[model samples]
Target: MEVAQGLCGRGALVTGAGKGIGRAVAVALNRAGARVTALSQTKADLDSLEQECPGIQTLCVDLGDWEATEATLNTVGAVYLLVNNAAVALLQPFLEVTKEAFDRSFDVNLRAALHVSQIVARQMIARGVPGAIVNVSSQASQRALQDHTVYCATKCALDMLTKTMALELGPHQIRVNSVNPTVVMTDMGRLNWTEPQKVAAMTSRIPLGKFAEVDDVVNSILFLLSNQSAMTTGAMLPVDGGFLAC
Candidate 1:
């Protein structure tokens, strides 16, 4: 009998893979021997990633468009690991939030994740392969943040969806979970939290007294996708620096 090589020889898919946490996850998976299919809208980012990690397949698609996303999924082949990391944050105060902003936020963050999971999970079932899925959630999902009204709602819904997916997909040997991270110092993160007062306030709340590096979140994602988390399902692992604990 052939021994299972875990991620090796398996196919992996990551969305929003052009940069930030998604980029990190895609690179890590490829290094671990998985054939990676990276999806993102930015061509330059994808091209740069390909140069950095040879042999990674790239797909440029906007997951926010429902019809386009469905069409894109048809082109995807079998994948054993799926990371729903693509998300958009349109920060607006609750009172001033527009319909378009709300729809776009939910469409990409919540709707896209569900659609991709459905497509990937179906492929796993058809192949009779045990698989793992990790949704890149946010700490805002649990704790409310000012001006993040819509973003918070979508993530909160995603968290609940993860639990339901785990419940139903568990019978098929597919584990589903999410990682809720605090402020990760990616390009976008730094832009929002660059002010000294904002940074200090945020850090003071976290027990670690520092924001997450992209790799910090990436390592957590890798753990959830690997066999090391074989017995874990319906779990929401926090990659926060103890912010929620405070």
Candidate 2:
């Protein structure tokens, strides 16, 4: 019996690869032998990942910029995998949310994914290659939480986008899916969950009794990107610790 090959010889692009889950996913893919390209708006973060994972490529670009994203897509070959992990979370009351906050949230969380998918999927179709797209959504898409009006709205839109893209791209042998996780213990989560009481409060909601780890989400993304899930598409798998189930 032969071992299955890693994502070797494949080209993968992951957005928001500066840190957190995106960075974890990029490293995981790189270790699995994929020629990974990580994109981030912060050069330092990109550099750090590139340094940590030798031979991995880094691209510093704001996905919110439509023209730049379009141009970047042109340089990549038939994308074997694309992880739309770039997102901005603006937590504010519905009435207190500013227009700028709302627009920026939508731009990064929804519009950017749309722009990149259009460009990458076109190349995939033209090359007659099969690929997978994993959108890093959140549990907020299915449930409401306090002070998450704008953030929830954006993720909800992303969920819809994932579904529609899966439907449309399926004919072209492109699989589109989403991985929704609960509060991940990343830098952002640490900042937001710093208060002991707040941490306790949120932890109580998760049946798993703890916040999600970065590797938890990364594993799910890799699974979706692999051939094991070849027949899977249009699926929104929750990596959340039973957060939505409760």
Candidate 3:
């Protein structure tokens, strides 16, 4: 019996690789022997990622910048796996949300992901490379939270985009899916959820009795990208500590 060659020699791309879930995914993929390229708006974060995983490449660009993102993607070589993990959340009451904030949220969370998919999927098709794409969405996409009106909307739209992309790209052997996670215990997440009342309220709702860790979500992303899930596409798997089920 031979061991399966996993991600070795494959070209992988991960957005929002500057921090949190994105950073974890990039590191895991690199360790699995993929030629990983991490994209982030912050050069410092990219530098840190490179230090953490020596041979991985890094790209500095704001996904919200439409033209620049497209141009940057065009320059990237063939990519076999893509993880659209970049997103921005502006939590405000429905009526208090300004048009600018709403648009900006969509710019990064939804529009940018769509554009990235188009460019990368095109490259895969032209190269005849069977690939996988995982979009990092939030549990907010399915259940609304107070002060998360705009953020919720964008994630919901991203899930739909995942389905549509999967439908269209399936014929070409390109699988598209998404992972919806609850509050992940990243550095920023800890600061934001520090209020005891907030923590208790959120945790009580999860059947698992806790929030997610970065590696938890990263493991799901890697599973979706690997051949282990070869027949799974257009699926939205939850890494939410059973929040959705509860």
Candidate 4:
């Protein structure tokens, strides 16, 4: 009996890879023997990541712009693994949510994912290759959170989009799935969940009574991107410590 290989010699593209879970996923994929390309809007972050993890190719692109993102991806080599992790969270009360904020969130969170996935999937189809895609979604996509009106909406839409992509791409042997996470203790997460009262309020709802680490989500992304989840698609795997189960 032969064991299955995991991501060795494959080409991977991770969006929003300059920070937090995205950065961790890119490094993990590289460690697993994939040729990795990390894409982000911040050049400084990309440079720092490239320095820390030698051999990781970096690209700077504002994913919100479809034209720029498409053009940039066209210049890169074919991608077998893609992580649509780029997102912007503009927190506002439902009544206070501005049109600008809504449009901006959807532009990067939903539109950019579609634009990038189409490009990658087209390349995969043309080359007659099997591939995988993981969309970095959120528990908020299923459950409502305070002041997360826009973010939740975008994620819900993304989940639906994931389903549609899986449906269409299945014939081409392309698997598409999403990983939904609760509050992860990244710099942004620490900043948002700092107040003890707020932290307690949120954690009390989780059966595990804790927040997620960046690696918690990153490991799940790796599993979906790797051959281990070959038959899985259109599924929303939660790294939310029972938050969604509650």
Candidate 5:
């Protein structure tokens, strides 16, 4: 996936960069010449990523710890781009959902995004640098899935969070938006979607008759983060294979 020019040397931060979509985005940003800081709870993953992208910076933090996450991000310099891609999916039926599962999911998915964005945005305001933030929401946010009650709720809340951020941060020229993808073929996706019955159930509903690959979602993120979508903010860009259209 290719990103726009003029991003070189600009500071960018991506959370949950240890694996899946977040890892891909961090690498893409680095290749696009942005000075990237990749944050995740996994140190080994960070080490591997740093080796792959020699100049990339990586930070290890458990985003569930609100104070620690806040403190850790405060150490970073001004960020021109931020991707709140860290999330946890606690798959439980609606009636079986527990308070612990709900709290943990929200803390990681929604609350952490708010904290990181607040810090990054304040820095941008202080430095007077325009910034862009992309939150990785999901298709489940719009549609109710059988066992994704908590995950869906968090994403739905995240979409609203993105909009409110766009409304408030617009004056500062800091754009915020969400990229909602259908089942992505990441490792996690494969584990969850590879079963014949499950695959058929989902892909049948998608006009393209397929689940999304990591690159499909990555390309959409590049557009939203780059100047190509300069006028886009508070918009939900679906990287699904027209899955929502069904």
Candidate 6:
């Protein structure tokens, strides 16, 4: 089979790559001919991705655990692309939020990306290789929705982190960008927006009149990681079906 050459001979690490947008991104990268290292907290998901793509490495590690994340990156080489797609969402009112919940959201959604980027950036810098880091964010970062304060806050922070990292790492030839998507049709989405009435109501708000698919998010990440976007950095690309524009 002749694979695409955009990322051929390149190595990539995609966090939370067991399912949904993460899984789709991993498959996209693999189809583009990159050697992918898929990381997720679920052993079964990782095993599944490994089965789908023989010789692909799968690591089961909770990104919330900083030490374990650091250890996992040590074994990998200088990567051509790093997708910080691991995240946790909390849909609760500010008054209902607990300190533990807040911390967990920030830790997993923001701090984990920081830790992984640091390790990956170090390797890239040391090896003097040009690379890209694509952070998976959300439309919630820019818009305030009911019962999504915590999730929105974390994504907002992630956007800032992307810019700061881009500034600091640019000289080292490391590009940092973000992909913000609206409600994606994933397991999580089904749990939150499965009702026909609810889906219709939400779709009405989006200018595009529908929620985004997992592939919509994956394709954007792939574009940012590829040389086609060599000049792009620190950009928060929205795959939100005009949700933010409305």
Per-residue lDDT of candidate 3, residues 37-98 (tens digit):
99999999999888888898999999999999998888777899999999998889998999
lDDT of each: 0.91, 0.88, 0.92, 0.93, 0.92, 0.88
lDDT for residue 212 in candidate 1, whole number 0-100? 95
Number of clashing residue pairs in every model? Answer: 0, 0, 0, 0, 0, 0
Query: What TM-score should be assigned to candidate 5?
Result: 0.97
Give the alpha carbon lDDT tens digit for every residue of 1-246 in model 6.
222335777999999999888988888888888889999999999888888988688889999998888888788765878999998877788899999889999999999999999998988888888999999999999999889999999999999999999999999988999999999988877787878998898889898899888878877888888878888899999998898898
What is the C-alpha lDDT profile of model 2 across 1-246, one tens digit per residue? 012143677899999999899998898888888888899999999888877998788888898899988887677655789999999887899889999998899999999999988888888888888889999999999999899998998898899999999999999889999999999989888787889898888879889889998888988888888887888899999988898889
Candidate 3: stretches off by over 4 Å: 1-5
Worst 10 residues of 6 by lDDT: 1-10
Tens-digit lDDT track of model 4 for 94-126: 999999999999999999999999999999999
Q: What TM-score goes with each of the models? A: 0.96, 0.95, 0.97, 0.97, 0.97, 0.95
Which run of 10 residues does model 5 get worst, by summed lDDT?
1-10
Cα lDDT tens digits, model 1, 1-246, are 012238887899999999899998998889888899999999999999999998899999999888888898888778999999999989999999999999899999999999999999998998898999999999999999989999999999999999999999999999999999999989988898879998998899899999999988988888888888899999999989998887
Specify the highest-lDDT model's number.
4
Candidate 1 global Cα RMSD: 2.5
Task: In model 4, state the lDDT of residue 141.
Answer: 96
Supply the TM-score for candidate 4.
0.97
- Candidate 5, residue 120: CA error in Å? 0.5
Lowest lDDT block of 10, candidate 2: 1-10
